[model samples]
Target chain A: MHNKTVAELSKGLAAGSFSSVELTQHFLTRIAQQDPALNSFITVCNDEALADAKAADAKIASGSASPWTGIPFAHKDIFCTQGVKTSCGSKMLDNFIPPYDSTVTRNFKQQGAVCLGKTNMDEFAMGSSNESSYYGRVVNPWGENLVPGGSSGGSAAAVAARLTPAATATDTGGSIRQPAALCGVTGLKPTYGRVSRYGMIAFASSLDQGGPIARTAEDAAMMLNVMASYDDKDSTCIERDVPDYTSTLNNSIEGLNIGLPKEFFSDHLNANMQQQVENAVKELEKLGANIKEITLPHTELSVPAYYVIAPAECSANLSRFDGVRYGHRCADPKDLEDLYCRSRTEGFGDEVKRRIMVGAYALSAGYYDAYYRKAQQVRRLIKNDFTAAFNDVDLIVGPTSPTPAFGFNSKGDDPVKMYLEDIFTISTNLAGLPGMSIPGGMIDNLPVGLQLIGNYFDEARLLNVSHQFQQATDWHTKTPKGFE
Target chain B: MSIKREDAENIARLAKLQISDEQLEKITGDLSNILSLVDQLKAANTQDIEPMAHPMDAVQRLRPDHITETDNREAFQKIAPATEEGLYLVPKVIE
Candidate 1:
């Protein structure tokens, strides 16, 4: 039961093969027993899960159950869960029990999905590795010593360990895809404005988009059916109709044009990892994809531009935590200024502070045009590159990260080194395009992700291609050693 | 493009974060490294490129000017660090 995908679990629930309570209990017990080492979950709601599962059982009995009715999954802590602690992996939010549910959480609840718990993440979704989480680093299920690429590391790791059949995750410059790649799961970041961001704690507003992480593309498609919606609450959420993402999963990809950017295949990618991505492409080719070499000339500038734009946006978004509100507040403040400074200082972790400081500096009066504005212009160039490439190809394919997951603290000392970890994944965010990471192959016992970048709001096509690829390959089915 | 100690201090102050003397040097170094990395943007010919604020160039949506939310002040203030009689308590801002 624990090893089953969400699709399989849903079928079992509908067939009455097992009760939602039994299935939910199985996952809750697995999390209790297995999560200590992986540290993937911040809060496991055993009681709440059982209650939700019981309700789902009733719904199933009534013959009014949706496909996700009894499905058990985890939500990344960044999404606000009413009455439950939604920490966003920060001590600042450690005590925050949202009085209301985020849009994403509400959608899941509406579907009658049993949420197992909230998974851990980088503080405010800032870091590339999960080490920045105040709850402590999440270990990769693939190898305990290797870092699960983050800030959605916990979500990816949870799905990889089969602690949950699926998990909700957000990506702002590779948070979802990188971790999914590292953990050997399928993760998708829908086009900007496709998924509502109303209750998602903002990292970089323009770049952040929520999606699903699951064992397979088919499972991810099921989760996205519930996640993608038009919400008036989130103004940025476009009014476009949400398609049934699973409908196109079996669509043939014959004559599909896939672009492989020359820049992505250069020295930035590890030779062996490149080979893995190429192998995945070859599989897609056999499925009738037409491969073509393309160029996104501004690829080298993406990381630099992202470093500026994301930090700048984050600095402003994070200012809401001023010690007077619901989050952590410092003691013994002599005045308002001290209260503000001390609370924020005590609340945020190092990476969070570094980004805030960088953002503040970039957006500062004298430097605004030089850094912030310059980065925005560079962002347009990056977007334009994608616009031009999409004209020639149906999708762009590459390695999700330059390399697979590294050991904890391997690049921690140097901020620039860590920034480069998302070199392959950031441009999609900059361009507001949909992108996904599917397990391509294993390198040195760790997983590498094959990235797919689609034209804006072309998620159905991305899911279709990814599902077709998974049907031909077994990479997404391979589980980590001890976990299996 | 290197961020000096004074720049780091000023940035922290603006961001309302307190960095102690012990942490300032390393913070400055890290900021400097980051600044230099972002300096790569200067090479791009962005002179004619329009700056993009949102990915889809989405304009903020406007709704009817009417109250949609039920008052939940009591529920909200329950989590505030300092609150009294439905008001958020804060350190003195004026004499």
Candidate 2:
């Protein structure tokens, strides 16, 4: 039961092989057994899950079931779940119980999908490694000592560990793709505004997009079918119609033009990691993709630009946690300033604070033009690079991270070294394009993710290509030894 | 691009985060390192390029001003630390 993908589980539920309550319990038991070691979940809603499962069971019996009915999944703590704690992996939100559901949560509830719990993440979706999580660092299920690449690390790790069939995750800057790569799973970051962001905690509004992390690309497509929707509540959510993502998963890739950015294969990427991505490309080529080397000249500038831009926006967005309305508040305060300062200082973790300070500095009086505006201009250059590349290619492919997951704390002290972990995937977010990371291969016993970047609103094609790649290879099917 | 301790302190203040003197030193160093990394953006020729504040070029969609929300003040304020008579309580701002 734990080994089945969401698609398989949905079929099993439709056939009544096992009741939704039984399926939900099976995953809850696995999480209870396995999550202690991985630290993947912050809140496991056993009671709520059982109740939802019972309701789903009735829906399935009545034959009024959507594909997601009776299926169990996890939500990254960033999404607000009514009456459940949506911590966002920070002390700031640890006490927050949203009065209403996020759009993503509401959609899943409407589909009657049973949610197991909220997965851990880097505090406020701010770090590359899950270590920044106030709950605790989530261990990569692949290896005990290796860090699970993050912000969405717990979601990726949980899916890798089979605690849930699929989990909802968001990517600000490689949060979904990098962690999915490290944990040896499939994850997607949809085009900006492709999914509604209302009630999904804000990090970097421009770069943040919610998607799915799952064991297979087909499963990810199924999850996207439910996750992608337009809502007036989220002003940034595109008003365009969303296609059924799963409908295109089996589409042929014959004569598909795939671009490999020359800069992505440079010395910056590990040699062995490059080989794995090249192998995935070869497999794609066998599936009828025509591989060509293209240039995204501004690739190297993405990380620098992202640092300035993300923190700048975050400083403004995070200002809402001032202790006056909600979230962590100090015991006593002398004045309004004291309440604001102490509450925020205590609520946020070091990485969160560091970003806030950097953001404040970038948007400061004299530095605004030099830092904030300059980074935005560079962002345009980065987006233009993708626009030009798409003229000759159907999609771009590259290694998701420079390397596989590194040892815990390896790059912790050096912020820049940590930032570069997202070097390859950050540009996609900058361009507001859809990107998917599928298990490419293993390097040094850890998984390597091959990233697929689609042109704006081309998630259907990306899902199709990823599904075809999975069919040609067993990389996506391999599970960690202990979990299996 | 290096950040001074005073600058870091000032930034923390502006951000409304109280940083102790001990953490300030380390934070200042980290900020300097991050700044140096972003400083590379200076080399890029972005002349005449408009800053992209949002990914999409869409303008803000304005709707007719009308009440769309139900009263949920009690439910929302339930999570607040201190509330009295439907008003959020905070530190004294006026004498």
Candidate whose lDDT is highest: 1
* CA lDDT, every model vs. true structure: 0.94, 0.93
Chain A superposition TM-score per model: 0.99, 0.99
Off by over 4 Å in 1: none
Task: Compose the digit string of candidate 1's lDDT tens values, residues B11-31.
Answer: 998999889999999999999
Lowest-scoring 10 consecutive residues by lDDT in candidate 2 chain A?
A: A407-416
| Cα lDDT of model 2 by residue, A1-484, tens digit | 9999999999999999999999999999999999999999999999999999999999999999999998999999999999999999999988999999999999999999999999999999988889999999999999999889998999999999999999999999999999999999999999999999999999999889999999998899898988999898998889989898888888899999999999999998878988888888999999988999999999999999999999999999999999988899988888988999999989999989999888999999998999999999999999999989999999999999998989998985888899998899999999899999999999877898999999999999989999998889999888888999
| Model 1: DockQ vs. true structure | 0.89
- Cα error, residue B53 of model 1, in Å, equals 1.0
